[model samples]
Target chain A: MITFSKQQLKIPKLQRPVYLVTAGQSKFDRAFPDKRTEELCIDSFTMAAQLLEISPAELKTYIHSCYYGHFADHFGDQLLGESVIHDRLGLDPLGNIGVKTGGATGGSTIWEGMKAVASGYSDCVLVMGWERMDEVPTDEGNFLISCAADKDWESPLGHIYTGYYAVMAQRYWQIFGKSEDSFRRTLAEISVKHHGYARFNPYAQAPMDITVDDVLNSPVVAYPLRALDCCLMSVGAACTILCDEDTAVKLTKNSKNKPLRLWTSAGTHTLRPADRMDMDIPLLPNETADQYKDLGERFPGGDRYPGFTGFLAARVAAHYAYGMAGITDPTEDLDVVELHDAFTISDVQTYEDIGIRPYGEGRTYVESGDCYHTNPNTGQPGKLPSNISGGLIGCMHSVGATGIMQTFEIASHIWNRWEEFHGDENIWNKFNRQKPKDWTNLQVVGAKRGMAISHAGVGSHVTSTILMDPDHLINKDA
Target chain B: MSMFGQVFVKNNQYKLKGDFHHMTPNMPIRNADDEWKLLGVTNPRAMTYMHSYGGEAVFFESLSQGKLMASRCDNSDCNITGTIYMPFRIHCPDCLAKNSVFDLTDIAKKSATIHTFMECQRSGAFNLLDKPIKFINIEFDGVATILMSYLVVGTPKFGMKVVPIFKTTGPTYTILDLAWVEEGTKEEQLPEGFSF
Candidate 1:
């Protein structure tokens, strides 16, 4: 495995900190046969322009470069999507590049856009991502996604993408020693929670009031993985406008949309699963054991596997992102999160992998109702309430669009735009599972620091990004 | 108005009413597809290409000769001289130096212990030969990388000792030239030993 020691990969101190001025996304759906991929990108780009309070033409003039994150050129006819979006938007042809990191494409593309502006290569860069998987047959789409795996060794050996995660889930079960009944319950609860959250999202693809029993009753696609445990193959797109600190201040001078400072972003990767033998149960070094006591307590209790978990890339990425943002404890430091949950197992594993909870105890966090939109006891959302936009589970999985949509959700929550845009009607409360009387919105009150983690390749590639309210980052003691 | 603004600008409350209402499953729109298809047009073809396996040929050539093989960087002045590669490498990945072609041709014994195994039910190549196809990652005694191949045994347990059973017929030049059977269980007998 690739080592991400502090001495080897130091926390980056940027000369020019980047900021997200505004972002937007089209409503996700199961199929968009009427619209092409380029049209979907244009739709998202137009929404972003409207939110920025600029005409499409005005927004075009400001963007010096563009990066389009698109997966599955095989599924669609839009291979030159960057050029297509640029030409369609009437933007000047400065430079256009396509970013493809499988499902991590959105996160990687946004990071690239930020780098372009941060390095003084451009003043403003437009980052957009999309996928149109529902246009093809579901089995064909599965084959396309399987192309991301090791083709010669894996794909030819009857190892589908879902089978890869199922193997990991089985391994996790072996290490944790959870009974089949308990393990099934844990997986079911995760699906039920995401579904509950999705009911509030108007744009969500499958937002029914699903129960734990419903998830349990769902057909098993693979051993230990039910159909409900997986994300939908939806069609959608998302875009973000990133600029330097000075440009952000200028853009948001008289607007309700406040700039969320891009505190730091980092990524780490290892392509193959077998290369990481120690991924199932990694031991925390003794020097940092005391610091991670809470996580240590969350250990599921096994003879430690004497190696790292497959989530090493995510840990390394999150560590770097948090380290540069000067956040030592993510549980206390982060206010909200939008993580990749392509599977129920991924959702649970991400909590531990990114230090939201301790390893092997993500089920505990879910069972405790910490991930609830509004806590039963406090009548408010918990600290770091996840998937407020219903995540990929509820919001739907549109491949390239998912990561950028995660970024947009956190930024919109930070801006607190729901009330301003939708007014104080509380339109979402009626759809809530409990339908609490005083619950207002999914946005965390007084939320300052938010993090977005996106990954792909059965946890081989990961990008962790930390965003903070500019005022809060400079004066943390307050 | 642009096509987008015209669609969404009517109001954000559009989905809650009119033609775009998102109903729950088992509602009015259950599994509906509104498509315009042109009938009688058949697109039947196949895509074929020759994949250059580069340095992997050294391993496969030995496999065709009824032997397993392992290769490593053997440049004396290079950084990773003894680092072994499973599928073979043309150059030393670490030092990026041209390796000795003959040094990568070492004969490997056909015995390894299973590191991990999975019973996969689907193959993208449409080649599922068994009810539940079993693939194993086996660790050769002296090799650094685990070799991935099919295990033709029933319910493989982790760390089970295995040996290769080569296909004397069919496409014998490829890595699919052999499937593994559990060690000491004979369905087919072989010569006691062979010269390298």
Candidate 2:
């Protein structure tokens, strides 16, 4: 069985604290043919500056370095796209580098920028990410995405990336879900919830009043994974400004924004799931070995740790993030989360992976309504609502911008600006979307802490980014 | 008409022949709503890629000979010794030693079962597999990792016994040359190019 070395298990320590002063995003849609990527990026950067009550030029002065994440150079048919964007943003002299980890490119970019500030290399940094999936047709896009898998082995099998992920959904459905119709409906409910939440967010795409049956009846891409069970293939840009304590205080002094403490940690597994070997489950602080000793017996085919049922990368990333941030239990400590809901089934899979719920019990998080903004069953606020910005399933999965979008979403709730952002008439008109008459504010009243999980292929790479109000630190020593 | 691209290795260098790329002129994309305004242009081009299998070349070549080659870490001093890899690891992941090739044709024929399987209804550009591809990840009796392959003869289900089939007739020299079929599948039942 595979095991971890002591050095590998050691918790990471940052030299100094990093803070997320402000964040922003451009309108997310299926395509942006009318605008260039640099223009979209400038729109997002302008909003980030606007949130700090400053102009883009004023904000550019504080940025010591830049980290740009654009997942597929082939999609844009342009390499060194970062330098072009940096030049367009008028930050030509600043050192900038590109980051790509498939779907986790945005989070990996943040992980790099966080280290830059935490290590005293840069007092202030700009983390920007965008994707241009519209350049290719749907079929060719699927082929390009499949290139992320092992080309010699897995990619040739239909050349569809969804097939690689569907195997895991099938395993989880049979073993944990027991192939129950109720479990299937619970999975569809996630689509309904995410799409429903999207109606209130002006920046969100695919805002539909779709039902669980609508999701169930959608075309099937793979068995047990329907068209609606998937995330939107989107094009967009998102950015976040991270800085040291002094820079953060100076940047957000005049604005309504609060500099939230930030911690970004990542973990990885075999790129191809076929290479996964049997190993003991890497326990989270909230999990114990005793709880999973009889996992195989309980779920029949659930014996193999992360065989086709779990994201070990997310589990390990959350482990390191929680350790570094001194969060003992996620469900009790954090107020909200934005999981990488690439698919509805993967959404539930992440609930288990990131310790929102235990293994084999992720469905309950949805079935019991704890994953909703307003628990439908009780009509009360959810224990810890997730994906209030509709997440990738309903918002946009623009690859490089997705993780940053999720972080921007969670930060809005913690800053008590969710309503102000989502309810503004000018914002809806700017994006040319009609405000839903039934739009309800989804702000968690006392959100002091939140997190976003950015993931790549079959758990190959996963980064957990945690943000908390400075005064609400779980561990004072941290 | 240009011939298909072909390459062969000689003296550790590639001997290339025929056309490797085809160029197509770009077409103007117009916006109908704005009185057919010029919006963008399509980039139409195609090129063949030459990829090397490197140390794992034997595994793909053996498929045409109806042989399933695996690799084993035979380092006696290594903590994890004699561990077999079906996907044919060039080097032992733990010890970093070059793995020894082990023929696994007989073992696969005797005992191979589907660990997890998926039926995909769609494919991407240039996909050769038929619709509703019965993708299966098979678990061998002694292999450390699972092998991903498509089922040819029968519908896939968890724990269903399967045996290997190879494209011995006209091998592609790629992973597509290796496939699986349900146990007791007859020779005639195999796909035209594949055989047990």
Candidate 3:
């Protein structure tokens, strides 16, 4: 398994074009004591139907099958939770299956649905994901999250998942970061940016208008990572419907939306990061071997591939996705992205992994003002805005629902309905959250293409979901 | 008298003893508002799992005997033969051949160095490690993969020379039975139940 064969490295191709017609999400919060998971799911499905300008029952008629993504049965204390949800959603006497790939469950669910539509097995498939973390307290929730790790090897250490990621942050800090004060500040700036963006997102769980000072002063969960740097433990549901070209066109005929092409490609590495072997960097289309030849010389202790400083799975996923979508460079080809920012430091790592920035220089992506809604340097739009939905850090890390939530965020931008969904006074009132006076529209103008990267523990599983306007594809046949 | 759950394998079948689960009544969770209307209930239960280490059981069992066992991929037909795995792989990843187990204690003591490390301030429920656990990933001279363990004494930095310490007195038969500390430390300075 050290060296990949040509068969294993082949770029995936869909048999027929697949499209994401519509998507929706429920209000995300750390806990939802008043509502059950099924109720939240119904809310998301109802919203999806509303987007299509159809009744929930009318939309249900188009769903030939269902793919449910509920990561932790332990958290819900229910076995076959997918069936329970399927029954509650009233989609019975139809084929349905469950998908679980840790935090990537949502993306993986959509991936399953995409394949179903691509192969013509189902014309339209319902991809719904939800998580109920409210049932357990904080420490117990952390315990359950830690169970995703190698039970015998890593889980026995402290039963804390943060400790597992903290080791990587420490390595990336000293090596790539050079343990500099500016680099630490750059990490804090990410927290400041995400939390600032959250104030505009009605569904975001931890909205704040905090400064870099506040993030730096926040209580340290681990050195180099503060509480503000971590993603939220949330409860919510999100969903998207995928269909073949015919079904997509029909579904969006009357609605103001258009069918967007969706291509999902996935990759995985060792569950235990310790087992990740040193390998050649799986270069993206935009990268060349000469660029990383001196990586070790520049950073010192940075040449180790898939080392604690990097995520091989993310790099592999991006490699497949870029190839499938004909993206030579993500910075140019893709307008926006929603990366799995489990930690602020991991967010920076993903920038390099996904080729938004070169290795040992992920800070440049933030420093250059390319990842913001608007460049702080100039009043112009940022070249590549990421996590406009506040991402997992400021938004919600509702595990199963997170990737679907991210898809909803990016799809809304492509649909040019960002202000409609996020800035609507009705939604703010429904959630009982007061909209900020200075709420800004984060819609990426002329966004023809976007992507959402869903990831699991320590680079174990990752999927890249690329959505593009059918009229504008880098590879026409794609 | 109530006893905790325990199990053992006999003739390829698990034999259980004592109570496997303890159940408690569900308590109503009533809202303080709206005249204390019932919202939900809390379900409380205590359970223990009988986990089998399988082929890697030797690695856990050896910790109590003051030995570190590593597996060698001896599949001659494999691409990466003779590669040693420190976390004790039961089978060779390249060829799926059963790995040959060998004592890695001496090499670990003489050549182990910290590859990366972290000091964690928080832990989840049911964790046995003390607060501020000094987590360290160790690299050996010839091992292919790093081994994640904890430093029992002294702060950890990159490439700090260390040796493994075993909880030989009262072993938990788990990874916690093995720990690490700086080299040249006195035997008397070791933690209770742990020794060089």
Q: Best candidate per DockQ, number?
A: 2
Ranking by DockQ: 2, 3, 1
For each candidate, give the interface RMSD after superposing the true interface residues on Cα. Answer: 3.8, 0.7, 0.8
The backbone clash count of each candidate, in order, is: 5, 0, 0
Question: A318, model 1: CA deviation in Å?
Answer: 1.3
Instruction: Tell me the TM-score of chain B in each candidate.
Output: 0.65, 0.97, 0.97
Better of 1 and 2 by TM-score: 2
lDDT of 1 at A462: 80
- Tens-place lDDT digits, model 3, residues A65-128: 9999999999999989999989999999899999999989999999899999999899999999
Give each model's whole-structure lDDT: 0.67, 0.93, 0.92
Tell how far residue A353 is off in model 2, in angstroms.
1.2
Model 2: lDDT equals: 0.93
lDDT of 1 by residue, A235-320 (tens): 98999999986778777675678888875355555455644432233322212554435533444423233222347767767766
Q: Write the per-residue lDDT of candidate 3 for residues B65-149, one digit (tens) a residue.
A: 9999999998889899999998999999889999999799999999999999998888999899887899999999888999999
Q: Native contact fraction of candidate 1? A: 0.22
Worst 10 residues of 1 chain B by lDDT: B1-10
